[model samples]
Target: MVGAEQTLEVEGHPCVVVDRAAMQYRVVTSDSAAVALERKGTSFARRLGRRRNTVTVRALHELSLVVERGESLGIIGRNGSGKSTLMRLISGQERPTTGAVFASSTPIMLGVNAALMPDLSGHQNVVLGCLAMGMSWEQVNAKFSSIVELCGLEDSIYLPMKSYSSGMASRLRFAIAASIDPEILLVDEALNTGDAQFGDRSMKRMDQLREQAGCVFLVSHSLDTVIKMCSRVIWLDKGHLIMDGDPTETVQTYRDFTGHLAKGNNISAVRIRDEARASLQMTEVLTRGKSRRSRP
Candidate 1:
């Protein structure tokens, strides 16, 4: 059963491979990571053994960011700093509950639940997935050659995916997702497993994407990728936006801030105070639509 399940080994292990550049609003969403979350709920048991539950996570405060065409915006933040959450929101898999996210076109989310088929074999699944992504049968048939070529999994593309190795399965998933010429593609740390050469090839693909296609979002921990591949960056801290600027400047600031906080100084406190100030500034600027790039 090694190759029983169809899997794209090279690009299969390297899911989310295209790494295409965003041409317009590639990072068009506003850089301000403004969100208002409200966790309000009450759970109680009444006389009849009936329980009541309320809803939470209402942060209606919205920061509308427009990822301009041809821009690469990187999201940098600590774990649980709402980086993944923001990615999900941006990908349109989930609604903002209060605000609205209107992309110029549909966004393709790689890590979102749409990349795989549970019952279908990997090879069969690839064709089905591509067609489902708005591609006509002819286009799917035509691109199948290139897709399999880049994925490098001709033999394994015919087996059931449930049996494929983790790496192999990941690569196949990426190959299928990329078959579509997505206008806006969302990737969430889906490439941290591949080797160096794979990374290089993927980067090349992303460059082509930006040059030929449209915009893309890469949510990853590789600062090198962010620095080397991205033209701009956005920093998030504790669900609040820390900064939005040039990658060189912003990544540097983020690294320093991370170091300061890791060293257990007054950095967290400083950041908290800064968040408060930033909130006020957001109020002023958002209310007027004239931001001064407030900083702490």
Candidate 2:
């Protein structure tokens, strides 16, 4: 007789997979984890006085999840919920301190001021990034036009990315990456940097990718985008996987959590505000960073 299977720990929490047939490994977070910003007080000796520095640790105990083919997934959580860290670990950019991460494909992160290159032009970087991703020159050529058109950078495709606006750079990066057709794509709030018009176009391209190729793991604070674009959403808080189910439900829960912070609840409002601003911009415009939006 086949009994019920059990949830296993990947990082530090227990994880259970719903669809075992389509995945080799799932990115899961254990419910029993700390999402708090625990600080260790350190003293630095100064000529004038001793200054105390508070260092915050964003730790995930155990998280396990399965990302299967053709799945458009959303990761949502509060300001120190360890959402971004999980993405980094899953994408092979960052290693978890304790547990393991299993990825079926390479994952890439697109963040503001990430400084992937401060010296290269957008065109030069496109070629370089594609090559780095293991795309042959011939393969890049085949996908070149489609990538340019999708990013709407026909006029500025040749511009030095440093001279281009942040939005322009973001569009170009997304275009090149999406066109590469990786088996797995990790997006960290890059689309929100785009203009409203571009956001619509980007969403369409993402839909095409899901229909034509593989899975996409999107970590954004925008509930609206998650609900509209993703088939499923997962919520994390203080490095804990608090909710994993429908996009609508997960997003709503996330919103409520933010609202609580805004109202000065038991949560850390300052950190939440910063996290929401820097990380959730894909969900909403960041009033602090660059004051960006296309003019009407």
Candidate 3:
């Protein structure tokens, strides 16, 4: 089961807390032939029997962290490293399989796969996206031109979103989400789709958000961008948080680990990873006037 608790913490509050959160999914390890047979109307009892071989895939291990207001935190990791899972949990889009996420406000997530209508034109999507973010009609209208300009879609704004390229759609999604100036923002790989000019604009927008005392969480593969934009960085590997600290040190360590892997130096990679895990400082979670430390 997953759970989210909205804390009374506000934009100017001290911190956003993720308290010993973890997530896992039960996967049935049935063969393709069995799946085909089930799709072809196999007996319910037989399907149930096949499903008995279920495996629990842990997406995140008891992860605990704190983010202060007005700070930009970057998350870096390899694919399937639980970065997206943590973002989804923070945004309340999904619940942790165990533990809880407490936030000052509902985080607005800007992802490459944000929910926008493919059949609708970019113009319509901007309106719908803004409204969905709790913006009034007047607010949407006021920000409409700015959003289109930031996306730099120009005439293409009239085209159906399904006809746009992935980059174009990503830019529009980012523009719409940024227009809201959310108190808590979660960005996942949306900046990777834009060119240098758009990247500059996106960076400036995030800086402005931070200046306004909002908290920002960025999940990106671009270590340079993470170091340049984030005040702090956290590294996750295989569903566990391995390092958290200054952007430069954490990213450099991650780079070294990956470099070892790229050169097929599994032994060196494992050594570096284990050393980081061993040195990690666990976070403390407070509940009902009692405090307990949580392991990552």
Candidate 4:
């Protein structure tokens, strides 16, 4: 079954297609300390104990969505609601447990926690990061100054990454990720890390990317950011997609639901959630030689 799920790129499409995708993990429930204690007992006292129970955790549940060229899509949900998992699946970092993901090009993932060598100088890391993303050394050299400028890391680029603040690192990551002019970009909570000036610069860069017929997927908890940067938004709750539509309407509904949850009004929250789920329209997924419709 795992072999059946794959991420493939379709030539010349510049879009993303996710069909009935789901991700699950099995976790053992037994306490490791207790198991170790039992193992240390004498043979006579080591009669077979109950087997450890394994439970399946669904990180993403039958999610299906399409992102076309020039579309900036925002994904919103509470913590542990599968936002990051969905981004991984879309970016081809992880295969879905059940369905398949298809894209026109390899998606570049930029996040606040993007991995960079802490001990290396920021300048060295930028060159290495660009190289890791398949950039030629000559290309890296040509774009090196521009990348640093976009990140607004001046002489500080010579300092070790560990010496930089969280916002500085995030800016550097974003600069590197955007340097390639990726046809498909996956942004996960990275924008929230930057200050207002950097945010303006980042938005302009994203706008240019979209103008060139690219697609972007953004996962952020900030409702205002989603409403401002995305033309469409999808709301997910507990791994289920609750709503997909205009950014303003979808975000407003999600905000109302969370507000109810905060006020200890689970009943109202559930009602809003169900209503949103029921209102979601079916999404059509286009494949190489066929197309199909499914509810998200």
Candidate that would win on lDDT: 3
The numbered model that scores best in TM-score is: 3
Task: Give the alpha-carbon lDDT of every model.
Answer: 0.59, 0.61, 0.81, 0.80
Global CA lDDT computed for model 1: 0.59
- Show how many residue pairs clash in every candidate, following the order shown: 38, 18, 0, 0
lDDT (10s digit) by residue, model 1, range 1-296: 00111121221221122111111111122223321111123233332352222223322223435466666778888886667766767676565544445566767776524557656787788788887888988988898876676556678777787877776676666666666666676778755644565556555656665455466677888888888777777776655556666888777767767776778866674775476436545654553432224322
Q: Pairing residues by index, what is the TM-score of model 4?
A: 0.81
Q: Per-residue lDDT tens digits of candidate 2, residues 209-274?
A: 657646777888777888987888877666655555678866765676678777878465445444
In TM-score terms, candidate 1 sits at 0.70
Residues 196-254 of candidate 3 have per-residue lDDT tens digits of 99988887877776666478899999899999889999999989888888999999999
| Residues forming the 10-long window of minimal summed lDDT in candidate 2 | 14-23
The residue pairs in collision within model 3 are none
TM-score (C-alpha, index-matched) for candidate 3:
0.82
lDDT of 3 at 225: 90
Better of 1 and 3 by TM-score: 3
